[model samples]
Target chain A: MYTRTLFIDGQEDYPLTNRKEVARLAGVSEATVSRVLNGIGPMKDSTKKRVLDAAKQLNYELNAVASSFARGRSGNLGVVMPHVPKVHLFSTYYFSELLSGIGEAVRSKGYGLLLLFRDPAAEFDYVSLYRTQRVDACLILGASAIDSEIAGIHRLAEASLPFCVMDQRFEHSGLSIVAADHEQGSYDAVRHLIDGGCTRIGFLNGSPQYSNSQDRHEGYLRALAEAGIEPDESIFYEGNYSRTSGRRAAEAVYRDLGRLDAIFVGNDRMAIGLMQALREKGCRLPDDLKIVAYDDSDAASFTEPPLTTVKVPFYDMGRLAADKLLARLTDKDQTDGVINEKLQTELKIRKSSGN
Target chain B: MYTRTLFIDGQEDYPLTNRKEVARLAGVSEATVSRVLNGIGPMKDSTKKRVLDAAKQLNYELNAVASSFARGRSGNLGVVMPHVPKVHLFSTYYFSELLSGIGEAVRSKGYGLLLLFRDPAAEFDYVSLYRTQRVDACLILGASAIDSEIAGIHRLAEASLPFCVMDQRFEHSGLSIVAADHEQGSYDAVRHLIDGGCTRIGFLNGSPQYSNSQDRHEGYLRALAEAGIEPDESIFYEGNYSRTSGRRAAEAVYRDLGRLDAIFVGNDRMAIGLMQALREKGCRLPDDLKIVAYDDSDAASFTEPPLTTVKVPFYDMGRLAADKLLARLTDKDQTDGVINEKLQTELKIRKSSGN
Candidate 1:
């Protein structure tokens, strides 16, 4: 008889036999069974068959979600992102990293992620998950400049639903926010460009609609003012935060090329686009033009010239946000100062910026 | 008197109200107010304010979910994906397209999505959702060659949790499945590659442990057999269907560069990665290394040499899965189908393969 121990929710449940049990029955290890599972590990194919045959005789239930729920937790999380559907394709790499961070955080917390794309066009309500109680709490990703999202969170608070916002710099009286210090990060990026001896700089701004975009623009101006260089309004161009927009902005700059020697791109996607445009125009990076982009996405590192960009602490943000939400949920009268956590961004100097 | 029309659980309740009765609300149409309440059309900022102020003054309660629930519908459909913790950068595109499909499908049905991730290390039971009454039905994604998922679904079936699987070529009894015809798609890719005058072709396969991967691999062999070429063992490599693995596999192929003149990558991510690697080595695309990839994600068109890939009916898969689950949920006895839906794949030829 094969016997294996398995956790059902938090309690032990006995099943007929799993590969682990088969391994136990054969006086081997689970790793040996894993080899059979993948058909790659060092176990002979014949031994793998014996383990499988032993397991076939004993039926085992391997549904983790059901077992976890039995332990008094659904092992599920409610993740709310701005229901802006158009933003995904243009900015996948950024959100991909964010998802990776949140996924890692949730897994550590012994929970699985349940994505809730709050349709911006629809009523901003968390009731779909809240009323049914599918998740323990919510993590709101990129909740910046969207007033309705804040309003929705306020409603959640009234309903006693716990949630924490990520990457949004807001000083609301009772809101919990975890974010990267974009102003300081932007300040550092511009300072690096200025120190590299590029006086005439262009700011490729994202649409000033988003609060984070506004902060980055403000940071750019602050850096210029601190350096005693008058802010150049003529060099600033506001566009959508996309590679296509980045390419267009770079082309716009190139049409009047001599006026600007360096450009600060809003995001890495746009930054890569801008660099591609510059390269197509036969402009040598760092020699002819200096580039500094924000958001060190996977594409940023793999760009033709490795990008010089600011890295946001997505992992830290996710963990801290989860912690904050959990804290607020447990403590009823714990409302005081807004739990605003600012993670510092690192300036990664690479070939594009002559670093 | 303030008059308001409240729709609760599909039952209309009208409370009579005058503009002065709700407080001296200025210059807002009742239609605009209704639109905002129903989450219908956009309203001017000032108009939105006047209506909200009036509603607040009248002490009107907004119950979005309750109304939907009153109709004996939860207005939520569950989405289940394999609990792979790592973020596939391209999943941003995959998810967006899928949600768009589901969104359109359920828009008329008045349902929202309940996205859940299954932990690969954890069990796969979905009975908790049923116990909590969170969603009506589930759409399972990425259940590849693993027969355990089928057994899990059978358990869910026993528990009366409706579910439908996508992208896998499984025809389990008493289950509904939506999948792309990868066998024919792979045949098309190989035929195209052969037509391009490539005799020695390399295959960047996905984890062969999967049923879909096995089907695609079999298709490749079938195509080779049809072409009267001996299916060489040395030209195949298995990898996780990601860009990084694609690049690594390309590098492996580059080490034995002259043996193969073309490559067929399992997914778009891998195809893009392989293209980048080949480009880095100054290998001319199509002219030197013709390529064909699968899953025409957004990045496919944006690759250096735009990818020539197969477009899976991703949106249709999502929709069909939703429909099947909904059918089962509406009436259990009505869900009698070995619904083996094989959606067609479109061959998108672009600059990468010199199309």
Candidate 2:
């Protein structure tokens, strides 16, 4: 008997024998025993059963690291998210929807998801995950075009790791990116508001750190130019995409609510907050002011009078990102070129747009 | 020169050399090179810089599997959640808040989170994760006391794995659990409503499959009994803790809206939906009927009339659960017994309860 302490369920010790002893007891070669234990290859049912029975009788336990070493795969995909304290990424509709899509896609592919949060302020080594073999491939999310983030992308690119970026585009042409057509979505939203007879429209946009926000701003400008409406910089208030910021922006916009016939808010969350603040100030929807928002999240339909917004398929974007990475991981020949997939967005008409 | 193709960012081939070659170039022993690469032990700053610079110059990449095998640890924690297709767990405020808390705690500990979704209806092997050494410890979330889930818990318990359940308590006594004191929260919410001069109060609850719902039900009954008011089963409606279900529940409660003075809802999502439905039916909030909800989510304050509800600390619960599991993982001697922690909840008074 090879008696040694074994930790099971973090509790009591269990007696166990060595694999060699189990092999001897089962009347099989040690290599056969190893194969059966590791589920390495196809074997005769009788031989596998005999080996298993002997191992169980002797209480033989297989070491996890040895098996992983023999298998040559960690069987997990990595999702690296930007860690912002007090931001509550999971609670936000954008992250949650995108994560849902990633989870769904990863599960369907029979791969476990390894989530790692990287603080933008701290020094992070992205290649360490691949080098340490914790994750087979990684998907980067919520990455801005900051110096460190750009350097991290280049590091991964230099190392030749299998990875994808969700919603963020890099200057590197070879980087794999899955993003929504925010410009088109914004254009449609502004066009909808323009068609509704709004001449002087205010634009409440998110921070420029994100590529999507920039695209949305461009769309807003393009729509105004096409409509022959001069872009008013004073009415364009930048927000951080939070409901509180939206409420604050509403205050700024309210000072010039007389000149502004309608407003194009960046996302539905801010739009909802803006509506609440405007209502508290005695402004009625569609009667006094009309609004068009983006990102048709779950709250859009439930908002008072509902919100007319552009729907960004965050879930699909996540799924596509995961699928693309998985494909690269599985197909050796497929891992050679850049893949830039820009998914389509739809306009959902609701009561807030004066429809 | 030995040349071989390598995948970098799932793209074209990159030239790379082995660790041994880099070690030779750096004029250091291979053991020193390994130490510098794995970040296992402290080395002289000059030697560490030399090794890294040489590796970077030569483009040396470490093999992930061999390093993991040598380290004898996965450096990851497992979180198993119930899989409900199209349900979008991330979109739900409950799961998202909890995950945020878990993520924050896990990242602070310098541990990676490995997420796995198990189908409730299918047979799942929970022990494989630990047995295969994929994760150091596991945390089970959203698990009901279904036969399979209970069996999974027992399997983990039998194996003596370092694990904890979040929000769900099993029949087994020795299982570690971290959850909110929902019964007390419910009691507080109902008591607050009763103190507001509302005598006939209806109960809108979630499915009984979850233990929290049962506790909330008990609290509702207990509060009614203490107030000397008979509980009306006719006014009770069941929802799936969704805004849509809440809207549907409002229809059933509307028939007796004349008789009911107030209603206690299971969560803020349902309460928001129920209020929308009631408003559409021309019912004045706090004038025709007052409402008290559970889970003071972000949307709770933004809802029309603003919900007065029981504040369930989901983020704190997640953080506490992660902390407990991490403690068990790090402390070998502390894993002998079960730890069941029930966190306290707070009541947030707002406009919806006529406060």
Candidate 3:
């Protein structure tokens, strides 16, 4: 019961060092010392006064230490992430690059990285983390554009806390966001396929809950319209941005392959899976079908015939988000303004795109 | 006991001030309060009820984080590792597997894991982490047997702090160590090669600084001696555990190809480099030169001729190390001794070893 504030274990607050000594000096049991030192609860005034006087005399770094993390700084940068069991999230190139970037910047400031995993579907209070936890600043990863998530982020914004969200977009919410230009990336990738004389292109994107996916969808549509090609909603597919999901979409894509000559995938994992599944279905790479993928993960180059991928600057995005949030924390002159940073993405044209 | 519904703080769930308040109300020691509240470690029923009643009385928010370390420690487990630029450590099979295990264990304990990267050659103070920072316990990964590292670990042991070293040996130092049975694995791998009717076997080893490498050397020599085949030191080669280093050994290995039929490599990375270089030199795998390597990394199976390798239980070692160190922190009566746990390893038979 080290001062339970709105925050859990008061996230950053350290309990008093030697409670036994203070209890003995106050002529009270350690429990009583604890109750009285809280400066609240059902403790009698005399007991509270005695404990306070003893604590003052002992001065066990209590005044400067207690509630410092909750109200002040705890020297930790909290990174909020989705808790997916058994998936070693960092093993993924996207997470590995992003985390390494955050680690580099956090190291420069000599700050500890506190990773907090929450079930994105569960009811978690994001605002309380800022109000009571020891985390001086926080950066949220993989935020979705869902109502519950938006409301949660809204609370954090309303409180005027120092935080930044990576990838996900909350337009006009005044929240700090660092992301790659996925819309432009997808547009460029699809245009390349069009330029290569591929008139019929299929778009496979992730869940619409992610703003990036929605942005990618818009880009895909824009590119097709600009080419004066009629939209083929029947050939457009949606995945969960997982390799398995991409594999699942292969059946649908295969059925419509006669009409579709090329496919643009949301991320490299999905592209790899799609390619693998397509190969199993006896489809020839770049001959019968051409492909383009996003994210450009390490596996992109290893895939058969390789992958023409859009390289999102996830590392730079993570670094920029952390840097801006950190500047808000340590830099007093830093004023309040919506920090909307959109880093550029590059195209890595490999053999898969028939280039 | 008050109802938990009446939260005096608007945002925070519970109306509790501190666990000391709950302890005072329960008329018990703070440590007893911690043990009962955690519901994780061993505790008496009477103590549990008392702590529960106290919590109910104060409307305290009962959580693992709030009261688990009421003794004033930062609720972080610092993971110290060597920092190499642009390497993306977590992307590697060894680091990714080990870290995932550590992450799983840490989550189960409701503690934050803090990653601290140190330049191996630069002077670093491990003791300051426990003394100044909030980290209650620590675990070191990829520690080498150097004077500086040993002295650094010695200081932590001298302080009698809760710490564990993963996959390293500090013989007779009484430091807690969790490592895989590399020597036995090497023995088994070599025996496999001998059982394949290879009379003249070459050995490609990593740097001897690591105790595991030394163990592998011993295992290799023992297997040869057991086979009554005179050990040939001239054909034995060493690398610095880099793919380039393994490639560097290919020239010497190629020159001795006429004298040797099989080779036992220290790790998959080196084995891969050797295989790639040997292949470039027009050496056919298994048919021309049988090979056995250690550490069945992700790339092990992806090689042109998949490697026959030893699978070290790095994940299990990491999980066990974290679990043991975490227990020592929460368990008051837990006594310390030389904790040396050696997990087993398995040999995977693939195309590279004439299997």
Candidate 4:
């Protein structure tokens, strides 16, 4: 079904400037030349070698950009992240793990990764990436359900773009999401603290803008309700999931230290900070105030008392997001519905939780 | 100067299938159309608006891939990192900080970041990235001076490609290198320990394959010589820059704890591990084992006793590498000679060094 462009050897009407010239010299069909050059379909070794040799003789370099445009594929996957000034996203265990997973998957598939950062406060056109044909598919990370963020998600969904949000969720049914069950993870951690003879337990949470943080908060309340323990607002502290914030939260909770027996922290970064701050204040871990945190990051095992935490499997979530997006890109017909994959989180019992 | 393809209305000889058609319809020179469409060079707003409006009227969507091929610039930078299975490179504080700097610089330049990973143990051609015209420039990260790795560096140098090695030094003068002064940083750390009344201090270093490790080891020896103390090889432990290795090193030194008054760790990851392991064994920090570590990472300040460490400006190094590469790409004539920039490191005195 390919149209052959005639390139007569001595005719002035036809110029020897296209793939047809290579095909003619190689004594192969134009389709074979296209397939061999693009590495798209299966081809015999002899035929492929002949086509390559012909192109080499003509010194015909393949224009990858032209070929990509003709094939309607960019061979690149886009990863959009939030850009916060002075805050190095890579320094955080959360983002680095997700990116590693995405990078691994994209590399294995022979695709390039195009990383772009979007300022959360600035107005941006996320769909312009696909409209400009810069990426075949996209994966969004660190997205909150803010007005602009949610609008961007809806735009992607309406455009029918192949994308998956890593560790972020929304109310839209058409959106694809890959995240850990933070609520259940949080519940399990709190329940573990209660089972360890802990009453009047405090909870340190991140910002409520993130769905995971909201879910974790809900889980904390649910676990407390189940144990017939009345929740006290005074013992709950809100942090921004940063070490600095964790230290500040520890300071805030120190006033009520006499009333608290245990505490559940949002993430390992904050947990590590809290532990250090409490230690500096002469509070003994597991003896004065036991602690349970989430995202059993690398720092968790090496913390002072080896933190007990919820292993959120961030790397797996990243891999699964890329896999799902790639699967959709490869098989559009079969993978039409919105796929929401929530990986399970395991509670690792370490010494810090009085285990 | 621009070539204008001839076309006749209602003539079967000419096909309206190229950028020439868009140029002709825009009533502007082909150069202006090319410049406006590619977003290159300054242009009058009225002229740009006219050209864009004309393109829209003609239903012409700019094929960026084809345009990139025609212009001979991809507007992308390639970042090649080492790929280790099951090991997330981003989870480490070292890489994340470097990447954050690189990302910030790359974004400010309006260029896309193309990330790729190469297996350290495998033989691969690094020049293929430039040969394929996939990136305008390249940056090599996490590279050691192994035979193949060194050969790849030479290949890029010989090819005269605009590239820089982040935090890796080579014997060749033709290479562009950006790294921290690890030797001086290590010397300062050890000297600080000695000044703090430490007589017999241990050294826990990473693998010798990395140049930083070798520099750190030299600094350790130099500091001991300056202090008029004989170096004891028996107290030296080799690690792989991991917390697990640090923990093991601590275990090995536990038997000789009575003989040692202080320890110098290569990086914070290993130092944190060492402290945790020693603390588990009933050794009090500072009082029992005064420790000095490298890389004042976020975890360092939040460690149990708030580790005292040498601050290697990884973010600044990354930014400098990117900035150097970008400068060469922009002004090749002025930036011809190889540039080697070594940023100074500072010792952050905290509680861990008994300060």
Candidate 5:
């Protein structure tokens, strides 16, 4: 009720200042401010000028949120992530990093971050984080989590909240995305290894469910095929980008260790773990077996022999996503269907790859 | 009136499933369901049992948010991040890492993430994000963009929202924080270098204005003092936690190459830059000069010879801060002032430090 009376008469927007406050500041009557705003029986044009000028100087954005609230449309961002067990928690740095970028992007444009972690709740109750008037937008990361909560998210989207996905390309969905050129990065990493005299190379792949993982795996396989080296199934092992998984992959290679001279890991986390396992097994880097990794994470430089890795353009992806979201929020008619941009990755050649 | 009737009947905590739906499910009349909820018009206990059973089967948490909206409070986490220029707009790692921990912690407890970036809007105007009525708590990351905006945050805190700062300890009134044990991390880095045949160690520090940076510097000095080695003022260079600063610090060391045997960099970003500069200047890890860094970031392990750095418990800090915030939210009587927990940092030894 108070907010209604505070609105400027005949104005579609909220008042820059309440009548009582404006009257006190400009030494004018509340009735006069109302008359000036409504254009009803205005005194002098100069007096009206005084009130209008004061409102302009206040620089109010006209309580768009309040009006939205009245319409049951809350402007917020719903971030849904997998609530994995503790051992698998830190292993999901990719999720964390991407969310951070998304959070930064949306918040800069004056939106909110609504985080949802899926756990074992009663059927259909888990995805309720997006059901209420909490977020106006959603950024879903990784496809597996989306699968589990697709129904709930669909309900939210139907309620007019814009939703997007990162790092994955869905065939049927119209969700926007900002992803790295993981395939190119993988290609470059393998090529670097080949150029450095690595004849027999091994591949440690991430989970096949994630599209990015699949893309990286394809790149690795293609690079091997193009180089006229028959892809070795024994040389390939699937990992989930965790240190333990990387270590296991290394152990799998060590079980039949004579032929491989280099290894290409799916991510830096697993690469570090693989390197650690290799070091423990008395293998020297670049001398016995060289290593290359994707994601060029902070831990890559701290491995026993620094790894050669591909650097994801996280910073650029983050900024681009934010800019895109801001552009979407500001322009109503700009529903240019899901703009998919792939930023380039840099191949950082370190000592592990014999560079 | 419906909510009021439910409250009068002591069924306010029960969620809103239409009486008709309950009746249809329970094979009862709408009046019977209402009588069961209201406890006024006589209804059999069996009928009440059926209605209560139906409500439980629906798996609903009473929409406390809708009620809170009526009371003018939004239950959301207000996250504050500095908008750093010349850097990737999105902090792929920072947000990903922090939110993974925080998102998991706040997931079931029902507080959503309310991310707000500190835009360069004359500092005072940055607080306008809170005017949207979407945030109930605040999570402030340590950075400069939001440094000048703390006053606005303070104003937000006064408006009855809880705020928490991470990776920083501010002396500001009414601020709660969870900071890393940078001092311990620095101590470990310097001690490791000393143990590795380094008598003259150089320090590449972050900005002194940052409380964490200052703590690290003090720790470096303390380690030197403990070893009866007077710190060489010329060897200590102030740098931002960036690669450019690392390169600058490396250059300074290279100008007087023989004076220093080891260098300790502040963060992994700068450490990579410093290592690049050292490598360019024909410096070999542990052979020409030993290197140790703080934060033990993903990129650190991938440097030329790999870095030996101290690990900052960043993820742990995020979890602890969230737990603290949640504890406060659940029990208002848990106000025991700022609970300062200094998580331990491990010194990860690698080839760069002659490991």
Candidate 6:
């Protein structure tokens, strides 16, 4: 029967129960429980038994997930995700697959998952989860590579806490990251289009906050340069990797569809929308707008003319991040320095690529 | 009825190896499975084969009593979900929306989300969570209604703990439940189809574990009764609310499609797959067959004809469950027994309904 109705809207806020709850349940003073648990003060046998029983029943020792782990830990791994309204991040193929992978690996390791949604527009704090004993380590789903994000991780790096990022890469060295090689994926996609007798190939990428978008852009330019085709900014369109945004870009893309023979679109969702919009405008796929999409999601095959896209191992990436982080936590594998593991991306050729 | 787990960005209609899920998987009586496990009765080899396949699909161990590590003061709200292997549970629109809503409400109330995935085939032990103090209050996502679940929840109810379930219902009174009026949604969908001159309307529904499936089945029958149309078993198909299952059911559905003018599908994913398969078999959409699906997921609008689907407020249900549980935790609302609530569903008339 503890009551503190004052709700804190802090980004790093942890749940508020303390030893007070345990003390109340055990009918013992807070000092006695704390001293007994911490092994700092002496107590009578009867007092010890009462406190111990309550503590044991309450899992007050914080031993969870991995039974092998020592006491004084919550035994939970935190997954920090950005709560962007309307995006439906969790439903997306990239996120869903990665999360499934993470769940699989985490479950195997016997650790509980603590899901914390971060407000993108708010302040960032990574240490509070550790300080509050809410999670022993965390895996950040991502967000863009903005100043705040970089700064937040930078603070985390300084704190020297155990955590890693999935899919997104920050420039900071020695920061653990598990991601797909979008640069190589994009390069292959563009190169395939170029080799397929397409001269003026345009490109559509996503938000600049995701570091991989820049990699994709660079790959786009590299493929163009390698094929001796000059890069044109006029042919480039940006989308937030949403199908709606892809449809919206159809007007601009169609205006330049005359100049460009093919365009390498970002993810498959945007590709689906862009293709549908172009189809609505009487643009025959491949003939009017040959395209190569990224992230060969489930929707790829579901599209009218099935999309040819780069398949990123999102699930494996998720699993790898969790496996690495958990191993680090357990001191199982002591391989040093920024455990950077980049999985390969395969380009799945289908009807959309006219292959 | 859905024996297959489709790997296509997945899914719906499963909880795991409990008596309900096991019975569901085995297509045998739950009592039979229990007797077999408890060595209370004899069973045939075919029954044993069914259970083995389920274990193979899950790559999971048979039921084991979850060892309790009770202790606490983590100051968190535990969200209990079945960790169904090979099914991308989080990626499905239903789960993601519900979780997002839960996340939002929990965040606003300044409580941490402790996500615990129960191995579907494991023994139910909810009391351990509270006894361990991992969570002050918990919200169960769901599984089918089974005896062990009821017993576990019965113990919780006896414990007089404040908890609730989302989008699921049990027979016991005084259990807080927040769910969608699926019966209403199904009724509206079928009635609309019937009013549009569809006499021979087929139905594709999910598993029986989900009580809503029964509601939907009832709704389908009610609509038929109102229209003075005899309900035919041959016109009914079962899917796990998965796109792949939908496609698989297409063979059987299409065999009987000559008699049916329209069909009411269980969910959007199944509709997409069913439609795709039907189209592949040289059936024209809306003209040859009309469809009204459930769950207006993002993919609902992305289908070639854009599904005419019933939009269920999954996110709101998630929010309500979290909000109510948290409110109860804070003692802000002294509401009485069994706060049962259901939200409305809307039928979105897209081209697929031939409107």
Supply DockQ values for each candidate: 0.07, 0.26, 0.16, 0.31, 0.19, 0.12
- Model 5 DockQ (Cα-based): 0.19
Residue range A1-355, candidate 1, lDDT tens digits: 0011122123333331354676776566765653343222134436756666764555432222222223223345777665454343213665655665666555454444666555554446564354333456788775655566556667665654456777665545556677788898899999999999989999998876567798898889899999999987888986677888988887688876798879898898788778778888998877888889998866666565678999877766776776565555447675444577888899999877887
Candidate closest to the true structure, highest DockQ: 4
lDDT of each: 0.65, 0.80, 0.76, 0.80, 0.65, 0.76
Docking quality band of candidate 6, CAPRI definitions? incorrect
Please, what are the lDDT tens digits per residue for candidate 6 over residues A91-187? 7887788878888887777567888777766545666556445677889986677777788787787776788988787777678888888999999
Model 6 lDDT, residue A78, Cα: 87
True contacts kept of each: 0.06, 0.45, 0.23, 0.43, 0.18, 0.24
Candidate 5 residue-wise lDDT at B33: 59
For candidate 2, the docking band is acceptable
The count of residue-pair clashes in candidate 1 stands at 14
Q: Residue by residue across B204-240, what tens digits does model 6's lDDT show?
A: 9987788999999999999999989999898888998
- lDDT over C-alpha atoms for residue A327 of model 2: 86
User: What local lDDT score does residue A328 receive in model 1, on the 0 to 100 scale?
Assistant: 57
Return the lDDT, model 3, position B221: 88
TM-score of each: 0.73, 0.85, 0.77, 0.85, 0.74, 0.80
Kindly list the per-residue Cα lDDT of model 1 for residues B1-355, writing each as its tens digit. 0111122113322232343343346455554553444343334556656766776677642332322223223446877666564564223555556655664555435455665556544345565444334455777776655556665666776654456667665544666677778988888888888988888988989887567787789888888899898988898987888777878887788886789878888888777777777777888877888889988876676566778998887777777767666766567587665456788999899877767
Lowest summed lDDT over 10 consecutive residues: which window, candidate 5 chain A?
Answer: A1-10
Q: After superposition, how far is residue A187 of candidate 6 from its true place, in Å?
A: 1.1
TM-score of 4: 0.85
Which runs of model 1 end up more than 4 angstroms from their true locations?
A1-77, A85-91, A107-136, A142-161, A275-288, A330-337, B1-74, B85-100, B103-110, B121-123, B157-161, B272-288, B327-340
Which stretches of model 6 miss by more than 4 angstroms? A1-70, A332-337, B1-73, B332-337
Local accuracy of candidate 5 as per-residue lDDT tens digits, A1-355: 1112111112133233455666666679876664454322214647867876765565322232343434344556666655666743433556545655665666555555666554422112222333344554556655443453455444444444456656776654555777888888899999888988787998889887678888888888888888898988878888987888988887787775688888888998888778777777987777878888888765665455767889897645755765675576558776555657898999998888887
TM-scores computed on chain B for all candidates:
0.77, 0.84, 0.81, 0.86, 0.77, 0.78
For candidate 3, write residues B287-334 as lDDT tens digits. 889999999975676465778999987777788888888888778666
**Tens digit per residue, CA lDDT, model 2, A1-355:** 1111121112222222376798999999887886566433345668878998997898674554444443445678899898987888998888998899999988887778999987675435676666555677888888887787888788787777788888877887678899999998899999999998898889999888889999999999999999998998988888989988999887887889888889999999899889998988989887788899989988888677789999999999999889888888779898886768999999999999898
lDDT of 5 by residue, B1-355 (tens): 0111111112123234355676788889865654344322224547767876885575422222343433344566666666565454334344445655676666545566665555533343323344434554667775432455555556644544456777776556666777777888899899888877788998888887677888898899889889999888888887877777888887688886689888888887787788777787887767888888877766665566777888776767777888888787658697546556677889898888888
